[model samples]
Structures are given as structure tokens and as C-alpha cells.
Target: MALRFQNIKKKFGDLTVIRDISLDVGDDDFLVLLGPSGCGKSTLLRMIAGLEEVTSGEIHLNGRQVEHLPPSDRNMAFVFQSYALYPHMTVRRNITFPLIMREHKWWFHIPLVGYLAKRRIETKPDIRELVSITAETLGLTQVLDKHPRTLSGGQRQRVALGRAMVRQPAAFLMDEPLSNLDAKLRTAMRAEITRLHHRLGGTFVYVTHDQVEAMTMGTKIALLRGGDIQQFGTPREIYERPANTYVARFIGTPPMNLIEAQFQGDSLRIGDRLLPLPETAPRGDDRKVWLGIRPDAISLTTADAADALPVRVTLVEHAGAESLLAFDPGSLRVARDEDGQSDIMATQSGYSGIVAGDRVGLTLDIAQASYFDIDSGLRID
Candidate 1:
């Protein structure tokens, strides 16, 4: 199912949850709304599901506007962070509740009487068969007769998913559905959900604050913050070519290092020294700029390299196969070398972000590193 969120806005009294948000999920696309807590990801998902009303704008599903449609009529299913299973109902009953509702319009899907109507109509067997198949696929077959209370967290989760799948809706909306699981189970569930997405071949709009989930599972990622989208792109595009400083910092581990500098004709000045920037970046004098470098893009050593700046070592953190070294390049300046230049030399206030006591060489990968206009937060590519 294709889904479009067109200028969707949501607010509660004075608080805006989503503002002028627009996004599209092609049929069968797996889209992740990735962000930190209180970023309005859940709010967006709810608006799509009709669990929450949009303060403004509209939502479309499969070319049809569904902003006013109740969740039931939207041809979608929502799996919540809470397993949301009925404790008194057995797995079979829970999974078939929707089917039973369809059969008995007046019964409201009473676990006991809904099946009675299904039996009278001879559709009970068919419902059982379908539910059983879904349960088996989700690894909930063995717990078919157990109450949700008796199942483990993972088992209960599968049951919740089973309930959603049995409806076979055109799309699935999940809001951090795996957040309650432990680390190991969460990793395993991430793989399982990724596979399920392929198996169903249906639009899946997932919301999560977990970057690990976003990076490993999303085919398309919409990174959001403070009720607005920071960037929306494929995982590779987001990680390699972030649209701005916020997206760059949010998408990476340990985050990108932000070194302040200025543009001095033909050289990039950090604090006091002049160095070269990639010919690709803008050039000017005393232009407020920031040097952005991913941790992996940086390396340290005692050997001499053309652009390597030597500095005092601060701390070394070794994580299994790789190690990280902290260094400060010393002083700062935004001046072009005596040689006529087009860009400002980079200044290295040094990486002593906090305790500045020693001078260490800081090497900038002008190639991999990005320059941003500090005042505007726009990339200087």
C-alpha cells in the first residue's frame, strides 16, 4: 500500500507534535521514522492510523485520502510498544478477534460468543486455519492455547504481531514495537521483522528512537527532530551524505566531531594556523565555518603525513579490534598562507574540547570531512 503524509501537522494545545510534515511510502516500501524521544515519531504514526487526529493537513493511503477514516476503515494495522494482548483471552481467540468482529457485527467480538456465531456460520474452521498459519509463521504455534500472561515477552510480542497479520491489512504501522525487549532479543527481533517485511511485501511504517533499528532495518529513513524532518533518505545516503549538520551528528555513532574554524582566502584557519580545505568547499575571509569529521574518517599515528598535525595524546579507547586516540592541534587562526590562496587555513583549537592542556596534531580529512556554515548549519559542499 502506498502512503502519503501531506503537510501533516499535529498539536496539543500549545505544543506542536508534528509540523508541516510530508513523506511518501511507495507500495511495499519499508520506511522508518527515526529520531530521539519526544520527536513526534509516534504522533505521526498515530495520525496515520487515525488514533490521533491531525491538527492540519491530510493523509493518503493507496491514492485515497483517509484523514477522516477511523483506524478500522483505513486498511491498516498498528502494533504497539506494549504487546496490548488481552490477558483473559487465549492466543487463538486474540488472533481471531478481528475476524470474529467481521462475522458478528452486533457482538463486538466477544471472545466467547463471536466464535459461536462463526461456528453457526461454518466460518470458524476457516478463521482457525488462517490464524494458525499466521501464528505458525510468527513462531507462536506452540503457544496457541496459552493465555498472553503465561507467555514470555517475545512470545507475547509474536502474538500481538500475529493479531495484526491475521487481518492482512494493506499496510502495517508499528511504533517502537520492539522497545520493550532485552538487547539480545531486540537484535533477533530486528532481523525477524526485516524478514517479515519482505514476506508480507506490504507497506511498513515503523517509528523508533533506536538508531540501531533504523540503520539495520529501514530501506528508507526519515530522520525527524522537534516536530520536523531533519533529513529523509536511504541508509547509505544518510550515513555518507547527510543533508546537514544535525543529520550528520544524529546518524553516526560517537557522532561527528565539530571543529570550529574560519575561511581565510585560499586557506582554512582553525584558531591560529592555516591549512588547506578541499577545493570543493567555499572560500572567503573570516567566514564562520565548522569542520565535520566522522570518527572513522580520522586516524592517529607518530609517522609524518602531508596534512598530519602532531599533538599530545589524551586518552586511548580500545574496543576489540580498533582504538581511538584523542589529540589537539593547538592554537587557532583563520588566515591564508603567505602563498596566495582561495580558502582559509583550518584552525585547531585542538580537540581538547574540555580540558585543554596539551598540543597534539589534528589531521582533517578535507576530503571526507565536510564544511558547514556555522551560522546557517548548511553544508559547504
Candidate 2:
């Protein structure tokens, strides 16, 4: 049940959104399409589900082309963010709608006698058995008679999932399915979806703008930006070795601290200060490059250490279980500085001893750092 996208592109007349997107999703992969809003992640997912027409490309499922197929014929279930359940129908009716439509003809919806026909369709032994089993699997057995209006957001989401599950599709396509829920419910549903994927062994393509969801739930991630893929790899690879400065700044919470420095020989010159490069860092002739270091990789010490850049603490934020220490490197100037020319921000996590106005030395784990070319915005090594 592998899904392959070859040179896929989507355009709305003069505006092109997805351009030359090609990706191979394995049979049991939980591939997440991740990016900021309006990145064409949802459009890409819809194209695969046959809900959006492909401008030009090939989509293959199980080695068979499906780009020309209709949504119902694709054999891929789509779970929408809005749930899209019938407001007037009970949980049971909503979950069983797909099955009934697949099994019955138009005559089944006759005006006043529709109930009799629907009952016959619903009572069919195989359909009833499948619906019952799916309801049980989704923990909706007790709320089968409840309407969507009366159900909790989580419960309604489960019903939507149940509807998709009953289809027994080869793959599941989700478009920001948990975005409407609160923080606690979203966390719970993330684990729930992951468990369902494991239990069913079906390929899943999920789209979301949240990095937390992508990093925590996806087996692999396709990071998109401006209708282009910035990087595609496991969470660890994308986090530790980003493809460029865009990816380096996007995937992390506080984001990888990017400092503009002059790369001269084996030392990175920050204005008047020099920090020694690690042995593994590739030597490049480019004079200007972006130095990327994770917040947790930076160590704050009261005493000066080797390869350390001294900075002055400007802010201290106490987040339960850990603290974030913000520092400003004095006299450092880089051409691409975002805040101001005099600001060189460094974040050190799990550090609480330092307060505002304290001068601390920053020891970067050079081995874990990344370097990106300033002009190209691409990783140098």
C-alpha cells in the first residue's frame, strides 16, 4: 500500500501552490506533512485522497495509478478536521452512513418509507457486524445513539474516525484532524491515533502546522515551505541536521539559536570574540555563515571555559521543570541579525541560577551545532 507522488504540482490558474513535489510513503509509514499555515500541506494530502485534482503528476497506490480516480474509488479514507458528521443523525447513523451508501441504492432513501429501507440496510448481518465492531474499537458503543450536537469534541472526533475505520481503506488521510481540540484533548488524541495506526498497520498521511504533533507522532516528516519541501527525514535528523536555516529555525520549540558569525579558518569570529569550531565541522571558504545551536546544547557557566562565548543575561523565564536563560552577546554584529545589530541572542535551557543583568559564559556543544551559508540559506556542512 505504498503511495508515490511523482512530480506532483498544484496550481490555481496563475498561482502555483505545490511545485514538483515528489515523495514515497512506505506501506506502514506514518508520514506527516508539516509546515506553517498556507504551506500547501493540506492541498497535497487532498490530491492524494482524490479530493483535489492534480495539475500535473502521477499518484500510485500499491503500484497502480490513482490520479484519475474519484474520491470514493481511491479506497483511501479521509478524516477531516471538522469531523463532517451529520448534525441530525446519531453517532451510529453517522458511522454507518458510509457502509449504507456503499451497500444500498438510491431507492433506499425513499421519502416517507426511507426508515424501513434504512432499517433493512442497517440490519443486514455483515453490515451490522462491521459497524458494531468498529463502534467497539473506537469506544463509541455507549454513545451510539447520541447526536453530534450532544457529544464532546473528543467523542465526535472518535465518531469521525470510526466512520473512516469502517471503510477498511488501505490508507488513512488526515487533514489537521485534531486542531480544533483543546490542549489536553489534542495530546490524548495524538496518542490515540498513533495507537490506531499501530493496531491497523495501515499507512497514514497526516497534515498539520504544529511541530510538536509532527515530531511526536510522525515516523517521518516532510517539512514544507512556500509550496516546496524544505526537508524530509526522521524527527531526529530534521532536528539535529536541518537542511537549511529555515528548517533549523522551524522544527524546535524556541527554535535553534542562529547567530551570524564570520567563519575564518577553524574559528568562528563573533565581532571581537572567537569560538573554536569542533573537529567534525566541515571547513568551508565562505566567510559568512549562520551558526545554529539548540537551546539545550548551550551550557551556561559562571567561569570562562574553552570555546565559550561570554554573554550578558537579559531575561530569565521559569517554565516548570526547566528554565530558559536568555543572553545577549556584547559587541557581536552580523549582517542578518533579526532583532538589532547589537543583539546576539543565546538560549540555555534547564538553567535557573542566572538572572537578568548577570554576565555568563556560553559553552556551545560544537559537535551538535550546525552551520548554514548566509547567502544561500543552506547548510554548509
Candidate 3:
């Protein structure tokens, strides 16, 4: 199902948590609401599920307004950060809980009668078949008879997913479902969820602060900050051409390097070095701009190479398959925090023999660089 949010706003007393947010999610699209904590990503998801009331505006599910509906009335499944499985129940019982709730009547609340009715319902061929299919699909058939306490973290998470899957809801709303797992398990589960999304072909609205998850799993990403969207686009579009400096700093590992420069005539002046502006960069005369260069785009060059900028290596980290080198751009002005000391990072494949304190010549790939307005922090196209 497709989702549309029109002028949505959420406020708590006097503080507005969500601004006038407006965006559309395509059907069967994996749209990830990515941002830091307290950015209203979870609040937005809850509003869609009807768990939180919208202060104003409308939410549409497949063209039907649903902002006024209750949680039970909305046909969407929510998978939370906590697995939220019933510890007392077996895996089969947990996965079958949604179906049981759907068919439950008033008499199902009576202790003795409820027990017999539930057993009978479980014995039904259709219910049994459905449970069996879901368990097998999630590789939980082997543990169907086990309780939650006996299962591994990943298995328990899968059970939670199976519970939601049994409902066959229009969309899957996940609020950092993999955050509880270890780094290794989170990676594994990320792949599993991506595969599940492909197989189910259901609309998924996921909320996460981790950029890795947003980049790898989402077909479309809405990057939010201060209750407003910084950029909304595919991963490549946001990574390659960020809407502003905020996004440029938030999306990458070491993040993009922002250097202070002067855009004059046909060249950019960074400190004492004058380099040709990127072909795609906006033209301006004596304008202050921020030049953004990705870590991998800067390469180690020979001292005699043309246009080579001299830098002093400050740190060298040997990560598997790549080396991250931090260098001090001697005369070039770089963006820094209150500490006033931030080195520019460059990535080199495999081991780079370069060490800290070593002076090296580096060449910036101007063709791959990005320029932004210094005052506004917005990209200069």
C-alpha cells in the first residue's frame, strides 16, 4: 500500500515534535525514515499506525484517509525494536496469536470455554496450514515447539516478524527492528529483512537512525532532522548529490570533507591553491563556498605531480580491505567543531604505508567534488 502524508504536524503542549511534513511513499516501496534520536521518526510511524494522534493534517493509505482511525482499525503491521514475543507461549502459539485475535469473540474470554475454543481453532486445517507455512518461511519450523527464552536473539526477532507476517497487513511498519542485535547479527538480519521485503512485495515504512541500514535496505530514504526532511531521494541520489551540508555530513562513514573556498570566475581558491571548479559546479564571482570532497576521491600523488596539495598525515587507521588516512590540510580552511581540530580523511585501498607525521602530496578529484553555499549550507548546482 502507498502512504501519503499531507501537512502533518505533531505537537506536545508548546513544543512541536513534527513540523509540517509532507511526503508520499509508493506502493511496495521500502521507505526508510532516517534521522537522529528525538527527530520525530518514531512519532511519525506511530501516527501512521494510529497509536499517536496527529495534531493537524492528514494521512492517507492507498488514497483513503486514515489519520482519524484507531490502531486496531488500521490494516498495518508493526514490528518493534523489542521482539515483544509472549514468553509463556511456544513459537507456534506466538505466530498464531494474530489469527486467533482476529477470530476471537466475547466467549473467547471465558477461561474454560476459551481454552477449548482456542485448541479447536488451532486444530483447524486452515489455521494449522497458515502457521506451518509462516514458520517454515522464517526458518522457525525447527523451533516451533520452543518457548521464547530458549530461542536465540535472531530467532526471536524472526518470530516477531512471523507474528506480523501472519496478519498479512497492507504495510510493515518497523521501528529499528534490528537495533537490539549485535553488530554481526544486525548485519545478518539486515540482509534477511531485505530478502523478506523482496519476497513479500509489501510496502515497508521503516524507521532507523543508522545510515547503513537506510542506505542498504531502503529504496527511498527521507532524511529528517529537527522534525523536517533534509533530503528525500534514493540512496545514490542523496549520497552523490546531497541537498545540503547537513545531509552531506550525515550520510557517509567519515563523511564528506567540507573545505572553505572562494568561487571566483572559473576557479576555486582554497587557501593558497587555485583549482578549476568542477564542471557541474555553479558559477559565481568572488563568492564564499564550501567545497565537498569524498574521502575516496582524494588520492595520494607524487610530489612533482601537477596540482598536488601538500598535507601532513595526522592519523592512519588500518581497517580491513582499506586504510583511512587523516591529514592536516596545512593552509586550507576546513570545517571544524568547537574543538577547532578536525583532520581531512582519505581512503586508500588495502594498506597504505603512509604514517602519521609524514608529509605527502594529495590530488583532489575536482570532477567528483561538490560545492555548497557557505551561508545556507545548501548545495550549489
TM-score of each: 0.85, 0.91, 0.95
lDDT of candidate 2 over 1-381, digit per residue (tens)? 498999999999999999999999888899999998989999999999988899999999989899999887889999999999988778877887877766664545535233743585456878778878988887889998888999999999999999999889988999999999999999999999998888888799999999999999999999999899999999999998999988987898767887777777887776556777778987764388788878878777763655567788888888766787767666654333334433434554454777789887777777888888887989986
Worst 10 residues of 1 by lDDT: 340-349
Candidates in order: C-alpha RMSD to true structure: 6.7, 2.6, 1.9
> lDDT winner among the candidates?
3
Task: Please report, in order, the local distance difference test score of every candidate based on alpha carbons.
Answer: 0.77, 0.84, 0.89
TM accuracy, model 2: 0.91
Best by TM-score: 3
Deviation (Å) of 258 in candidate 1: 1.3
- Model 2 clashing-pair count: 0
Q: What is the lDDT of residue 74 in candidate 3?
A: 87
Model 1: per-residue Cα lDDT over 256-285, one tens digit each? 666777788878776555777667777877
Residue 156's lDDT within candidate 1 is: 84
lDDT of 3 by residue, 308-331 (tens): 878889999999799999999788
